[model samples]
Target: MSAAARETPRWLAPAPLWTARTVAAASEEFLRPWIAELRTDSFLADFLSIVGGTDGRSPADLPATLPERSDEDGSYRLFPSHSRRYYLVLASLVCHRPGIPDHTVQPALGERALFVLRRIRQGAEKGFVPSATDTGTWQPATAHALVPGERELPLHRAPVAAFAAPGTAAATLGMAAGQPSARTVRYGYIPVSGGDTVADDVTTTYVIRAVLVRDPCAPVISAPTQPFELAGPLDPDAPRRPSAATTKGPTS
Candidate 1:
């Protein structure tokens, strides 16, 4: 529950799980500050991999802003859920697509990799209904280092404190992998029916994707799925944080 709701009436029972409002509030609590910082700061040098749409739209095709409220035009976009989507984009640095001539950045990772990337950002909320369909393993470098039953690595420390568990660092990487190398768990979802709702309502383990950055200065869990160019111009029209008065639901 949100810190504000910690005190309840003596007559009411404690909330069994963090409410949707609580989760949304929490996501903002954790993500907004970072967004604000990123807005003014240099994107800190690093390679990046922003997710392009399933149709493979270039990152340039991605709107300058992300969906902050459920009713916004970008609401139907991927990285669904609460306003967290807005902040995630703001905190990221978009790079140029490697081989494409379009001058736009591309999302090279498959869709399932994208889902894991977002859920990790959702932090430690309880209701984790995954939006990706039919999960399977595809090994990547980080997965090799942190898979379940393996010793914890320095990068294994909570990807971010918001979504971390006590043993999340040591937590099993989940079911067996297809290869001994790090396997990527990929899934695709059709937001048509209750699709976006899963991102909002369903609670699953807040698992994040790990990038195998060899650099000592690199962040463990990151926004881009993989390293693109070392540097590129960031999106000038990236989303900004909304005021408290114009509040929306929790993505905490």
Candidate 2:
């Protein structure tokens, strides 16, 4: 093996054999803490303020112009800092109904947006379900809370999906100041949104990958999960094949 390949840590084991149920469960596990936090009124209030309110007035240039904490770089910094746990808002997208051309919907970020977290907890025990949107092409109004137009919109809930993975700290990238010299890395997820149709294919399989660096000088170790698929309405004009959404590291 190459020197870098040899440096792969034992903890950086191969991804588990993923099934729809297993994916849902893992997604739920990652989100449970945030979900509990959302259940609290005070937490919801603070989170909404961070996300800006859910007024339903989304910016015309969404995904491109999504807001971020001034102190943060690419991902929006989330709260509960006192606990030393962090959730970062990595990417957000406005998905449209099937048959709608890509241009009509808000453009997607080159980075992977949140996927399947919204429905993981409440969806069927056997599989995944994407969140639903009411309009043909709608921009997400807020990252922190579900908006008014989406079907079955709930109050005090996150509009985007989230998952957990191992990642290097922002300081490593010089995005933050005032850090210990030693490198810091943590397992975290970038919040993304998925609804009716993230893509035009009848079924889309997302290949989730994780990369970790144990030390500043260590070679990065990478792994990929078993293919996880989500069903979507088929667009006759679109190719009849499974589409792939590969995960790169977080936006930053």
Candidate 3:
């Protein structure tokens, strides 16, 4: 084997096949330090204050915009932390998703708006489902992409009903901070709202993460259950130190 390859740490497996809870606990343990930092960091506290009360999606853009605590730099290669790329997993929480075209299928616009308003008022008191509006396009709003009176569906009266969810803290690329980042969103459906469309039923569409699925916010049905992570950048010329047992010199 090449010197570098020989030096690589021999990977080990957790006591054969581990249980699901074992996995979750392992992941929780691994990320404990980072999560603690987030809980106490003044920067995060201020950012949470900015994010908490607002009617934003759970772990939404607010999390995306939070400044990365790691020193961000562009020059390092083989280092994932250089730009502090991140992924997040969040569970169902009271949320407001911006409505879009699919929600505007009904012919009579007025009726559409009315139905959503009624739903909001009648929805469970625990969560506030906003009344859907005729215009919910924020991306296009600033660009003046749509003409007046030509109202497209906007997200207004949406509520997340899913119960307890797991949370995972992952890194994020500084995309919002003028750094390059990739974001992908995947829609999830419940038994009530999947498959071929039927008229008159509320089509529940939610992000798998209970928020936007982007580089900053990711969904995790299963997280690592063992002590594992990507290997740090390996140096080709570095010497490999012997293991603890081998390194101990003979007692004189």
The numbered model that scores best in lDDT is 2
The reply for model 2, stretches above 4 Å from the true place, is 1-185, 196-199, 213-219, 229-252
Tens-place lDDT per residue, model 3, 177-227, is 132222221112111111222244543221111111112222111121111
lDDT of 1 by residue, 153-220 (tens): 22111110121122221111211112121111111221211122233443322223323222222322
Candidate 1 wrong stretches, greater than 4 Å:
1-66, 70-134, 137-210, 215-219, 223-252
Report the C-alpha lDDT of model 2 over 1-252, residue by residue, as the tens digit.
Answer: 233433223112111111233223544222221111121325333443333313442111112212222121222222332322222222111112321111111113222112222221122211232345533333232222333333221111132111112232222322222332221112223233322345443433332223222232332212222323332222323322211322222222
Using Cα atoms with residue i matched to residue i, what is each candidate's TM-score against the true structure?
A: 0.21, 0.21, 0.15
Give the Cα-based TM-score of candidate 3 against the true structure. Answer: 0.15
Identify the runs in model 3 with alpha carbons over 4 angstroms from their true place: 1-40, 53-60, 63-89, 93-252
lDDT of 2: 0.25
Cα RMSD for predicted model 1? 20.5
**How accurate locally, in lDDT, is each candidate?**
0.22, 0.25, 0.20
Worst 10 residues of 1 by lDDT: 8-17
